[model samples]
Target: MAFPFTPSRPLWLLGCGNMAGAMLSRWLESGLDPAAVTIVDPMRTDAPEGVRLCAVPPADEPAPAALLIGIKPQIFIETAGTIDALTGPETVVISIMAGIDGATLGDRFARAGGIVRLMPNLPAALGQGASILHICRDGANAHDVADALARPLGLALWVDREALIDAGTAVSGSGPAFVYRFIDAIAKGAEKLGFAPDQAAALALATVGGAAALAAASDVSPATLADRVASPGGTTRAGLNILDADQSIDSLVARTLQAASDRAVELAEMARN
Candidate 1:
């Protein structure tokens, strides 16, 4: 579907690496006008048809309506000065870099209209990603612009407090990797049960995919669905018993998320320093 909201000025992408490239590709596929987009990435070789690609910002162009920052957090401070000229009081800044807080972005791009921190996973390349947004200021236009840009990428959610963003980073931003690990473990378990390597991998992947699809389509909670599947005294219940015993699975997952969230806080502190 086409993005319904239009920005007052053109949009500029500060970097076009993997994450930014995914977002750009999805935006173009969703009917965004390529002519309205500009990319500034020294390493990028090209851009979508009708889109302009430049190693540096154009000297004469006016500040863009929205500037999406997709550079690495480690180099953001070093690179912030270089892009300062592109931000103005009317320009909105959106960042997808992990750990950099909205306050820091606001300080770096002080003249921009607003700042938004977005955490998106790698799945965005397939347009099935989950994104969490945290706006630094209160403005309908800024929020609308962000929503417009995020909707095509997949599930888009907004948090009231910026601190919650770290929690989101742990859950949604780092979630795909955890899911992938789970899938790999399942495949290994199947192989251990005598299934051929290739067959085990396929079965594990299909089982996860089908279960996720079913959960998405169903009205009941996943726990309810799980209960429904584990018929009284059945094999499914036998496996679930092990997983639920002493809440082992739950504790493991909680610890994993905590570690990720803690790291996000550390990164934010690093950015501040």
Candidate 2:
């Protein structure tokens, strides 16, 4: 289904980099009209076919039904004043820029109908993303509008507490890079075990992909699935034993997430200033 865009005004995207480009692609695939969207990006390298691209927000145009802030947090601060004109009392301001919380957005776009903070992961480019959103003020049908925009990208999750948006950033937003590292680690292990480099890479990627698909389809928890794989004293059991020993993997992942979450908090502070 196509996104149900407001007929009166277009959707204004303040940036069109990697994450924003991915979202636009997904929305287009969902039947969003390219003509109904306007992109204001200094670097317009990734714009899809038929979408409007502008170096700056256009002057003398109607306020957009929604304004999506898709730039980096630092860039958003630099350009916030410039794009402030794009939002109005009927516009739902949806921001995907990390580190900037709802209060900051509310303060910046005081005339906006509502403010929404969205955290979307890399997989969103492929319509397989997990988007975490926090709606600060549900004015002008903001909740439904945010849902409509997120639904086309992937799984949409609404968090009641704005702080959880940062937590989700660590888990789902930065999670893909972590998973990629794990896959590479497995590939390196395979190489050490005598597999060719190309073969190892392919095997590692396919194995992880298939395993994730299985886990998603399974009714049981992933822990149960892991147990089902290890027969007593078998090779799988041996490998599992090493991973489970002293909970090293768990501790490492915990520290990894904590670091990402902490950085997100720092960004928020920077945005506030």
Candidate 3:
């Protein structure tokens, strides 16, 4: 679905790195006007045709209708002054920087129309990402605008509480790396079982991809699918038993997310100070 409301004023994007780049590319591909967008990134070499690229915030232009801050959280303070002039009471500030809370953003951009904290994973580059949004204000229009921006990127969801964004960071933002590690572990296991290194890696990758695709398309729970795959006394069941024994995998995953979430909180504290 398209954005419900097309921004009337210019949209300024600060720091067009990987995450921001993916989002912008998706927005442009979804028919957002390139002429209405300006990217401010010193290191970025180019932008989609018709979009303007600049090393610094524009001084001549009026305050933007929407400003997206895509810079790292650690450098936000250093970069805030440059983009401060571009925000006003009419400008919606959407930040994709992890660990930065809405309260901090609200304080930083006190005059902004609204503040939205969004967490989008690397899969966004492929338009198959999961974007979690948390807006400072309570209203349908704010959600609509954020949703519209997230739709082209991938699965878009909004949480009632801002704290949930950090939880989402643990599950989605840091999820890709965990999934990659699992895939690598699977490949290593296969290699130990006699498969060639390269062959094992390829098969492991494809298996995980296919399973994920199937799960995405299926109506039944993955548990049910696992039962179907493992008939009585089957090889799959044998392996699953080891992984499921004493809920080892479940506990490990919980701890993993907990660690990530804790770190997010630490980052938030750092940003606050």
Candidate 4:
């Protein structure tokens, strides 16, 4: 319930790939001290100035205040050995690794003072991202510490029931891919109807982007917006009718989310066991 965090403490990031790199870019852009970060990735040779980056641990760097694990979920077992210096009672572990629950992560990094599982999407590269955080009710963690980790990146919220986080992941974490697929389908439809492939692709992409922006800014639901676009039994409504017929589109998306959520649940089981 109570949140506590010291703003002055340093934050270190491990595994700076696309997602984690995006988060660090946001932090640096937001004017957080780049000096506070140390990135250890065997592949990345350079980071922005004022930040220390290396392929392996430096011989004598002091322990970090917060250690964020951004490695792929499947490879967390490799982190099992980097315990003594990286995780301890003073260090808070912020895990961005998907599928691994807080309990399992805590077990992997037992020296951590507190463990929090944060699920974030790729849009974190910009300031627009959806992040879902899960912290156990009986935990020793502090909410403000989680905020300190979350607030800098983007739109952050907590899920009361951890089980729902997989739903959140299915919708937000993996939603971009789904949207892209939709866009491609639309473009392909246009091409089949005789439009040039390049123009069709561009039009579909712009249309989807603009529509999402409009929906986000509008007070009405998407269904209401669709009604506003469709004149009395007009073209948009014709498409809508087709999609509504047999509720096929809705059912397909429902199955899509179910499959993704089930995969997350299965991954949690694998990690726990």
For candidate 2, give the lDDT: 0.88
Instruction: State TM-scores per candidate.
Output: 0.94, 0.97, 0.93, 0.90
True lDDT of residue 83, candidate 1: 73
Off by over 4 Å in 3: 1-8, 138-141
RMSD of 1: 1.9
Best candidate (score: TM-score): 2
Cα lDDT tens digits, model 1, 1-273, are 755324446789999998899998989888888878989988999788888899988788778878899988987888887776788777778888889987777777756777888888778877889999989964436788888889889999998899989999999999999999999999999999999999999999999999999999999999999999999899999999999999999999999999999999999999998
Instruction: Give each model's clash number.
Output: 0, 0, 0, 1
Tell me the tens digit of each residue's lDDT in model 4 across 21-54. Answer: 9888877787767767888888897898888887
In candidate 4, how many clashes are counted? 1
For candidate 2, the 10 contiguous residues with the lowest summed lDDT are 1-10
lDDT of 4: 0.77
The segments of candidate 4 whose C-alpha lies over 4 angstroms from its true place after superposition are 1-8, 137-141
How would you order the candidates by lDDT, starting with the best? Answer: 2, 1, 3, 4
Model 2: CA > 4 A from native: none
TM-score of 1: 0.94
Candidate with the greatest lDDT versus the true structure: 2
TM-score of 3: 0.93
State residue 140's C-alpha deviation in candidate 4, in Å.
8.2
